[model samples]
Target: MHDTIFDQLERDGFAVVEEFLRDAECEELVAAGLELTRHLPDAPPTVFSTTEPEQQQLKDKYFMESNDKISYFYEKDALDADGKLQLDPSISLNKVGHALHLLHPIFRCYTYSERVKALCRELRLLEPAVVQSMYIYKNPGIGGEVVPHQDISYLYTEPIPPIGFWIALQDATIQNGCLWIARGSHKSAVHRRMLRSPEDRNKCIYDRPAPVYPESSFTPVPVSKGTCILIHGNVVHRSAPNRSAASRPAYTFHVVERKGNNYSEDNWLQEGENAPFLNIYTTSQMQ
Candidate 1:
């Protein structure tokens, strides 16, 4: 692991590594994402969507498919009556997303790569493993804005928090909805989480008030394709909607310590053998 990248993360709560992936690697990753479209109809039932009416409607149907494998969700109008996305995906879909890394070899390569394991070691995360993965299709015009929030707010873990590793498969710009982070916010003590209610389990609620950081502390981060952005668990961040004509596609995964974590049963998503986490590393070896 590069010291510069680790230093930046320690100082700013996040770090941006340019060209972490080569041009050819980026092309291959993008192609893998596009290839997922052809198998959308039969993919696992882990799909989710933004706040668009049409897209939100499909969430229930897809979510009920199968909890053991990968799934694909899209923007409201991306699918027709036959549950198929348009041939020209650029204009028809918002994203083909949710829990794909372990199920797909192409994505697993990056999620469990040696390069990533080294970074996890640098962070001093004990027994680090991937807990979640998603590919965002910030398509033009229809892509929705993600409100400011922290990763630990959703992926609740006690004593240790999850770190996000976001990869830019295509150029990410302010005009096309790149991430904006609250600089140094990770240093602030924000221990609460946004989790489902224990009584209903279906209801979403926060354990405590959300963190309040000064607006002036926020910084817009624009990165080119192949760039990797490392974000601390407590750092507050968000992204605007994609209004530009271009698309901002990205692959993101989160890592958390396996031992000493609560791994609450009430957390919204709980299914499969491993349920919510995937082993990315083993003692004396990286998976």
Candidate 2:
């Protein structure tokens, strides 16, 4: 705690906070994350790709309607050639996403825990609203690579950009695909935008070229369990594929300023009237 998280975030576009949560807390979250799929309905398997592939575009209703539900997506390689899972659900699942914070009890409690409130206050996030939550299970041997990109590309806002809180429930290492970020890349413009197609509501389109970084530009950040990585909205970051025998579990979410920012209507995630994004300042869970 020598340098403040805010200072490091401003200087590097990302900050590492070690021991933010204890081992017991991390274990609780990991076990809770494992049960997320039980809340999902019986739908056809949907693959959550870290890389946007034009051939297997995930722009259908299943991906679009997950903003308010606890949804399960499978790892691409975990499925057989016929699109059926080749492994158990626990090992084949890629992530549970979008609404865990607002809908799930355990996730909601942690999302608004005292430590999170203190962190938000310290970062000076006035009128902050939760955008999305993800519990990523980088399953052993089949974990995919997340291509380098800026967060603003998906969660766009005018005037104010979003910030992400990525917490590791398991130890993150080079072998387990720890995050690699381009230092100070937030100073650059957003590399691309994920916009809803004008004609087709079921389609998602990219505006600019996808991010491509040099090998030497990124620095791998390996953190122990219960640590958090605060990422700037415009920072270029990505993770390699986990080919090791271990699993990497992480809980991440984004917060946006609601006061001075206009959330883009064409963004991938749109809040409904009945289930609007929760403001941390007024959420009862904060207490």
Report residue 70 deviation for candidate 1 (angstroms): 1.7
Q: Give the per-residue lDDT of model 2 (tens digit) for 169-261.
A: 999999999999999999888788999999887778888666568989999999999999999998999999999998999999999988878
Q: What lDDT score belongs to each candidate, Candidate 1 first?
A: 0.71, 0.86
Best by lDDT: 2
lDDT of 1 by residue, 80-134 (tens): 6666654365445555544566676778787778888777877777678776677
Question: Which residue pairs collide in model 1, if any?
Answer: 55-76
Which has the greatest TM-score? 2
Angstrom error of the Cα, residue 37, model 2: value is 4.2
